[model samples]
Target: MSRMDHRNNRRKTWISRVSQYVDSSAGRISLTIALISIIGLYLYGREIRNKIAGVPTPSVVFRDKKRRRVLIIGGGYAGLLLAKALHHKLRDAPVHIEVLEARDKFYHNVASCRAVTEPGFGKQLWIPYDRFPVFVRRNCQVTDVHTNYVVTATNEEIPFDYLVLATGSINSIPSKFPITTASSQAVATLGRIQRSVAEAQHILIIGGGAAGCEIAGDIVDRYPSKRITIVEALATLLPGRAVTDEMRKVVTEKLARRAVEIVTGARVLLEDEEFELSGAGFPEPRRRVLFTDSGMALDSDLQIVCSGNLHYNGHCLQKLAHTHPTILDEHTHEVCVRKTLQLYDPMLPHIFAIGDVANCITSKTIVACEIQAKVAVQNLLVLLNAEFESGVGRDDLPARLKALVQVEPLQEFGVPGPLLFITLGRSDGAAQLPFLGVLGGWFMRRLKSQDGMTASWWRQLGYDNVLSNT
Candidate 1:
């Protein structure tokens, strides 16, 4: 044997010994322990980072013999997040937080446009409430809200020490599902809409707001050869205080690039028009002519109404109008809330109104809901920990409630500012940031268009395993 052969033999012996050790039981146990230690360290580091960033973490909750009930109406984003935050903060306190939602599943309406336009996408958007960390009672409709209790549709009165009204608004289909819509029905509705869009050659979308633009964009993206028209009563595409002129121009241009026709300063006459074909033997939809106020005759096979005919879900508070006239806005029918997100009525200091239901001076968006939820949680905590005299009137208890925090309109702390991202299609979209100004298709695609942030939401609600299976 030469020197080189000897060196090779020594190297092979070392490899064989290491391989044999790795295959042994003791080595396997050591590897498992090392893996678990690494995972434990990673989780610990993540917890510390979350704490420093002001993110709430779930803790082991201890139940007291007598627990105070906290009832939340509408288990949408606002109500669900509020329940989670309260559960985290009051883990050791004798408090039971419950959310009452009419729908069986939590609908991610942010991606609703794509859900309607694309097949098999709706399933990911409809998340089951069973996986939610806090207690959420589904299919429970709140018929009325009283001072200390709420009346359910089933005629059961649920008493609560504190109540949160988060019943959001009801928009047109695809933008929002009906309050009574179950998970199966909602999925079927989205499938029907997808079929309708697929069959129609000329599709007309009423209202040039976010919903209309997104629907048109998604439809045209799926069916490029189809003619899609958007009609708005306003002069511009996106009309709101949050939308800048630059943002409007970019959205308009993006839609136009997709060959989506925009008809502004005109209203589609919806009354007394044969808008669709539905009778037997007419399996295929036929084109119908729709006249606008500006005498523009548009022919379309499908017409989607995304106009401002939204019904605010604050009517449940009408029962309290006899006592609190200003509880619900007479014009908008939105719940009138104070700056602290508490009910405007002094008699109902323990009741709060947040999200789209509350008449906050900001655009109704998820970001707004999140900011409002944080404020409501802070104020709720202050009230929960405060010492109140048994017979003290709410009006006289202002001194004790002085620590209640007020919401900063449109300002989510740690976030730059109000952010708006609109996806045109799978590959194209637009957005308006605080300091970044308006971004084009590339940025929007990477940010929201790919999976519509569905995975992030599932992960946020502690359903990461669902994503893996999907």
Candidate 2:
């Protein structure tokens, strides 16, 4: 072999070694960087998810705008829906809406009826308002009404441009036991109610509305040992509800089978520790001396007065009503102009009202409120188009679903609650429907029929976001 060939071979060997070293080194560096980037990305994503999911997004963002401001009072189904709608619609818009609620959490009154009657159901009713972004103010009951300003129980004044009065209606009886506070006392009281059913030998449920009837059914469902009686002043149970005849028969029979007694047209008057009833036989509202209309007045270990849902005055509602319901009255039965939801005065044009505080009415559902909030956010951006000739417009506006809402004389869901799921110790379930019509279910025997509440407001508060298992 020649010297030239040998030299070439030696050079080739050196180049091959260098290439192998470079390739391995590059592979290690690249793998290390990739692993680090993956770890960093995972951590960042986790933190973002936790914060974003802590509560529904605050308000909204607008386009072609500096910033939009909104204020909502109450975190009810209606109020929360409004906030969510605004965020979804105006994410790109310059909108910032704030919800002012009296409590730190949102308690759904709908589910309370069943929870109180049935065991292991109350905790599902409360969802803290802090889970969402609206600035939550707890223990601040609204007081004193005025134009553009809201005075709270604490005397601190909050100013707004547009006002909403989503405070809704105030009911008396159970309203006194609002689950919103989640006070230890309340939990204890609820426990006591359950215990009363377990220990008491006899129960007297006054009134025949959903509460009175359901309480009887639910008690029977829980403790069949208790003798339950329902005293209704009305001619029939669920006078104007939408229930079917078959359902009514089934309910009545079930209660009768359980030896449950019901007496219609019985007016109870309390004189001392005893209750007297006035019936039809005697001309002057004949009073029962010791026995009841059903001829069985035993000492009751528990007496539940589930008769009326009263309308106590609300300061925020009064002020909002004095200021803007008049404006909304003219725009009645339709969605309020988007910017009109701004916490500003409608007459002034820059101010708006949202949630229940505003007079924008259409069957006060959370979905409706959410839609109004979204529209308000989009419109705020449109109004904000001062620098440019063209204003911001809706790209993907949320479609408003027609909700079933009736407010003539302010009747709440006049339909009879589900009988199979009735809460009244069951001899007293009532159902009234439009066409299918006129029914009642007596679950006085089962007591544990339907544990699911129909209108749980906690869902609107986004409780399902975290408590999926519940």
Candidate 3:
């Protein structure tokens, strides 16, 4: 072989060996980095999830002999829907559900303004909770709640693995609870209100929110000749943070057509003190005097306060608020919750809060309550099932424990545009569904006002065969 050919061959051999060595080293380094990246990412993801989940609570451990208890306080719309959903989700699971409600029946308070105005509709408003699938403890007022138990007013200690708080807001007069849940007793209380309205020549409603607007509509519809006035402290009727001038004008015009008067930017005095009722712009011949903070005076035979939602900040709730300020609103005392509907405190994963009592959502209507109930129940079911599976010697802790689902936040309602259903009376009303814009005509009355949703609610509560008027 020639010297040139031999040299060329020798050079090609050196280049081939260099290329092979470099390729092998690069492959090993790339493989090592990929593995490290995957492991680090997994660990980081777990840390984030753990942080979101708060503290790992072993409070829900299940003993083979004992049935797990899921205690719910307050039998309002939120509580009822949660109980029903949980029951269905864990029908075969070994768990006991209990509802502690002060009243024996579920009073549809949304229709309350209409119920008190019309005596006949009172019966349809309150229905017994006896038929509920779970155990219903009547007259059971929860005075305190702790990590794993709740204390009743009678000093009864009810143990629970998981606790849900749905105690709704307490309203003022006219929107107040009935004296009793018994049909007869409720009828008597409602009768007195009806009789009072019948005797009164003039009525004044304080607070121009939904309650005030509804009550005004009901009274004016029943007694067209009676003088009715709405005294709102804010500048507009239906004074929500997001309420628009157009929405306010719509409600104001409807009520005005019914000859109901509205006084805005005036604060009504809640004291027993009386005024001359003939001062300033008010007319003379006062039957009864009413005074305001704005120096406005009016005459009315009956006055109903429909302002403010009083929180039942019991000693236990207050204690919780003090310890976990992040989970409780300082001003409202309503429990702060995550989008998952679980209590915002990372340490209290087993405890959940919903409905008007939970300040996470903007709207406090039944629509919002139902949405919260579903989200809370699904996540809770996953939690409880994880605990159950773990107790049964499941090795996959991560997989089982990650069952907690998330809930998307709801769009804000009752505001800048239209997202509320306000009935003027049996014949006239307005409604606004998401994406549907504003709705009117007889459809609104037929949906809610005509029967006050008595039938729809009864059926939803598992009374399929029950009569509508019952």
Would you list the clashing residue pairs of candidate 1?
none
lDDT of 3 by residue, 1-470 (tens): 99999999999999997667546857545544554464344324443565688934223445454567788888878899889878876777677888888787787778778875787666677777767787778888887777667888899988877789988876654465632345557655666767777778888887889888888988888889999999999888887754455567778888998899898999988565332221111112236676899778877777766775655332356656667667777776688776776778756766888888887636667766776776677667667656665553233323322422221232122212235677777777766544444556344665677766777778766687444335
Ten-residue region with minimum lDDT total, candidate 1: 275-284
List runs of model 1 lying over 4 Å from the truth.
1-65, 272-286, 388-418, 465-470
Model 2: lDDT equals: 0.48
By lDDT, who's the top model here?
1
**TM-score per candidate, in order?**
0.79, 0.56, 0.75
C-alpha RMSD for every candidate: 12.0, 20.2, 19.3
- Cα lDDT computed for each candidate against the true fold: 0.75, 0.48, 0.69
Q: Which 10-residue span in candidate 2 carries the lowest summed lDDT?
A: 399-408
The residue-by-residue lDDT of candidate 2 on 1-470, one tens digit each, is 79999999999998997667546857545544554464344324433564678933334333444443455566666666656655555566555566666665566554455655655455555556655645556666666545445687778887643344455444433323442444444445555555555666777767765556666666776677778787777676644333345655655666667676776777655454322111111011122333445555535556665554433223444444555554333322221333345333334344444544444434333334445554454444344433123333332111100010110121111111222234343234433322333333322222223433333344545455534433
User: Over 4 Å off in model 2, which ranges?
Assistant: 1-66, 117-120, 133-135, 172-182, 240-258, 270-299, 317-450, 454-459, 464-470
